[model samples]
Target: MTTASPADELALLTRLRRDLHRIPELDFDLPETLRYVCGELEALCDDVTARYGKDACTVFSPCKSSLCMFFDRKSEHATAVRSDMDALPVTEKSGAEYASCHQGHMHACGHDGHMAMVLGLAHHLAESFDELPRSVLLVFQPAEETTGGARFICESGVFERYGVDRIFGFHLWPDLAMGEVASRPGPLLAATSESTFDFHGKATHIAKAADGADSLEAGMRFVLDAYGYMAEQAKAEPCLLKFGLLQSGQARNVISSHTHIEGSLRTYSDTMTVTAKQHLAELAESRAAEAGCTCTVHFSEGYPPVVNDEALFDLARAALPDLHELPEPLLIGEDFAFYQRHLPGVFLLLGTGTGIPLHADTFDFDERILAAGLETYKKLVRIP
Candidate 1:
């Protein structure tokens, strides 16, 4: 098959990455991003189709802008590659000329690079479509930064339609040196669940503290109880509880009537997630009762833990041998777990050299590191 050299491919990917970086879009409704991605797919794939999630029930809002591009669709078995299309809410401070033109939104997670590498793979595969043994599906998923678009695409019946046999995905990591890649057989990332606690109490003048229920006190008790619960759970298993926002009354003279606590929970095991969440709910109820207040727990169902298929990891290790085995599982979460749950798949990480971490205002990576990702995708495409 005729294809561009590695250097030329990297050059093309760099240009595309820059163009995408300039027009960063947020979750779900990415009209401009969708247009640009479809344009690229038109030039490379055999058949390009767009899919949408369930409607919003009221008000015609733009649904997820997901695209599925095919190459050699007649093959009985197909392999899928996913690239998330959403950007974070951080403003771009990366002094690069291709910095985000959309103020207050930026591709600080290297998703632009991810899209470019996948697009490059599409181009490379299109050049050799006749010789390819299996079909290929290029998934451009939106809203990875917020609601998971992967689940929506999966439920949309693309997998059944394409007869997908296996899938692969990767994320660029700035923690590792350039050219380094890492993955393990099981539990590469943690199962994550987010929660918000709303503590309610009777509001009254501070001078009459005995007559009023103090929500601020209830909130503090809940926090302490949560930490205690997390610590106890950690004794038996690995778990993390992080509190990001704690808010209470606006006036000091008034006894606080309401308080809100926002935090996230992470664990490597589904069992642990259940236990931790149960304990948290119980703790909130018990503490609220003791503090003479009411507590409501609002939990956001989150992505499952990313567990690599052991057999697929073998293929990955053989196809790309230079990978380093990760010492332990990561606390972060990935929606790629949704795909892994459906079929044998692997989620690999590419090192982009150390610097500002992902999601930071200054997050950016060297364009050359994309070569490692491109090479890996090329190798995976050839797997039988």
Candidate 2:
């Protein structure tokens, strides 16, 4: 097999990214996307396994797509690299020639770039399989934008079956300059929990305000109290609590019988998340009682914080020249955190410098920067 030159690798990545970008599929139901990715991997990998619905036997048994590729050199342990496969629901507005051909879905989160980089690595590895110091596993995960797909992958027992020792993954970031790589040693991304509060009360005419219990008033009070509580907690440790939706009242003349509050809480530690949720629930219950209303609270245990292994991070920093060390962690959540719980893993950020935030309809980047990400992965898998 002949090795690809730098120019040839870049061209391959550009073509792959554009082709995947055109087919932008959503959470777990990726038919065409799965076919495209699996075809590419099967061509270059020594063994390619495609897991579909009910095959993995995980909680997400309905998940229709995920791929795992292996290059076995008879090494005792393997290095794993992951790339998420799902795209956002936003319509294409970037106006690029290779923009999403799917009408309502788009690769607004750079999953296209990620897939291209990992596939490029696979191609490179196939050319020099005998030269590798250890075996490697390439993971293509789905439903990262909705349900936590990494958790499903972990529960599938593939890592233990393959003897994976360490894993690495990357996300394209628009905050830093193009081609710059950035990460922190610990708590690189926040753990997230989705919260919902429902307040129940009586409804009456506006003219007779005393006849009805005000659920809206109770909900508003809880919001204000939760904000103050979160603000106080942030002084000691970084955390966030914010509401995006608050709906109450059906008409102008009547008091609302129900008020719904939806929001998310972000924290670095599980203890902090528990404490915050307890306080929020207390506040909601008390405010509702004071307003002569009833309340219910629900919290979904979302993905854990992406905490990088300090030893692995040191190894990466020393190996990659363009790698930048971040002083603080970002509040964004990632499913990649799930992999870190089982074994050593490092989540990296590659700069796009496009000024277009992820998940936006207009989010896009120069395909040339994908070559930088490809190089980073190439260097990571070869680390001694």
Candidate 3:
């Protein structure tokens, strides 16, 4: 029950975090990331598998050796916890000596630290499996930054194979106080995904502009109109639409023939999200016809809204410190929402003590949050 002294825990977590931070990988297809994690999991869990693996192994393993022994011979049910792997495409500017050596890749989202703390939890739970009643499953998910890695794990029927009863997960938030873990009972995080709009038009040379259609302008109009339409939804409820990129125009003299508008959408309500998708299709076609070009709006759905299980969160509330209500529904997105959808679970946001928010190039967080996360999850598995 008592292990991983504060000092030892800090030292081990620091090493794990630094090691991972140095080699940040992008969402999905992270072979190196998987290799390193498998090595670590090999030492802790009695059984491990790359469950529903994509880039990295969404590593799954039992903390205990057998069911009867895991339940202390009484036996209740099995449970699982998830920690996301993979970093944002952002370039590292944290200036740490161990900062990502890979160009244009960074763990600005604090996922590196999250991975370590969850590993710490895995070690703690595995070592104490004799005392812990519920058999624990550690899901080291990948591609959470862009797609629904949690969904992949669930769809793989890993839970059915393991006989898991509930799930638990968490994220780092710079807005909250240090050592504080906060959550909402239901819809803790919104459903978010990418929707791309492409416009195709005939290219024209600088001298003969009349011979071609400017698809770039057509894409631009659709982008502008989409913002206006989406703005109304935000005013009504929590929603977000940002056209992050426009790639089409090649030269100053010639208008672009083919243009792509890439962006993201967020909504707490499935109805609103679906509505936004439908609006995207309508606007793309309407604006394209207006500009005498063909336009297509393609949405690469990311993840569903995080539906927190009330029972699981109640268990966390009993175990965690400084539990509080979220200020509001977060517009930011996450793949953890995928886990909440499959099983009754809770996704917490551990306070990063306020500074630069996640996904920023300059993002940094207090390392001490690692201890808070470790203690919180360890207690979550042990007490309940």
Candidate 4:
């Protein structure tokens, strides 16, 4: 048998990426996507396991959407590499010949590229399985865009069962130079929570303004106070609280009886997130009280911040000479944080250099950049 040359491996990865992109699936209900991924893994791995049903956290269960593949080298410990299998809800407009065939669904966030890189790594492992220093686990996760599938994978106890020592994953980033890889020692991505505030008051005709308790006025006051509070908090540490939607009145002649505000809170630390939410709730209540309105605030438990393991990152930096260190943390959220919380893990960003923001309808990248991602993963798994 002959080993696949670098050119052959690149071609294989490009084909895999395009095939996965054409059948973009969302969340955990990925039948075609899982089938394609598993078919590729079956030929390269020693064993493959498919997980279905509810996660330990009891989150949504899309049957047979997640997969774990192992290559046993008779080693005591294993290194894991993860790739998310979900696609965004954006329609394809990239004009590529291989644009998504599934209407209203596309790989706008580069999951297809991520999967290709990991699959390419699998092929590399098979070519040299006998010489591997430790076993390897390939994780194809679902629901990363909607429900935090990494949480479900962790709860399945696969990491403990495989004796995974450390894990690694990557996101294709448009902001960096082409093929450049980057990460930080800690807090590479922010933790986020969705928040909604409802204000209730009395309604009356405009002629009797004094008799009406205005809910819209209360909402506006809360917004102003919340922005000021967040700005002040940011000076001390990185945090963000901003409202995107505010709904209230219907008629010009009548005072509104209710107002609803929806927003998100993003912070780099759990302590900061909890404290900011508490302060915002107090501020909302205070503003509502001033306007003679009652208010309720709700915050959804979203993904935790993606904090890179310090020692693991240091080791990665020493291993990959091309790896760049990010000067500041990003405000975005990623469920890859769940894996880091379980064991020492490092998340990296591979540059697409296309300058298109993620989740956009026309977002696309050159498949050639995937080779850099594959090379990075190949080196990471070899670390002793």
Model 3 alpha-carbon drift over 4 Å, by segment: 26-36, 45-74, 88-91, 101-105, 199-221, 247-259, 290-293
C-alpha displacement of 59 in model 4, angstroms?
24
- lDDT string for model 2 (1-384, tens) is 678998999899999999999999999889998889888876554332222222211111222488887777668898999999899999999889999999999999999999999989888877777678887888999989999999989988889988899999999999989988899998999999999999999999989989999999999999999999999999998999999999999999998889999999999988898899898899999999999999999999899999999999889888887789898999999999999999999999999998899999999999889998988988998886
Predicted structure 4, TM vs. truth: 0.94
Q: State, as a TM-score between 0 and 1, how close model 1 is to the true structure.
A: 0.90
Predicted structure 2, TM vs. truth: 0.93
lDDT of 3 by residue, 1-384 (tens): 366679888888888888888888876767777777777776554332222123211244332110111112134566777787788889888787888988999999988988888777766655565577666767787777765566677777777666677877788888888868888777777777787888988888858867888898888788888889988888888888898888987888887889988888888888998998998899889888876789877887677887678777777777765678776777777777766677778888888886687888888776788888888787777755
TM-scores vs. true structure, each candidate: 0.90, 0.93, 0.79, 0.94
- 2 or 3: which has the higher lDDT? 2
Q: Clash number for model 3?
A: 1
Instruction: Give the alpha carbon lDDT tens digit for every residue of 248-301 in model 1.
Output: 997989999999999999988889888888888988888888879998997788
Put down candidate 4 lDDT per residue, 169-233, tens digits, no spaces: 99999999999999999989999899999999899998997898899999998999899999999
lDDT of each: 0.83, 0.88, 0.75, 0.88
Which 10-residue window of candidate 1 scores lowest in summed lDDT?
52-61
What are the root-mean-square deviations of the candidates from the true structure over C-alphas? 5.6, 4.6, 6.1, 4.8
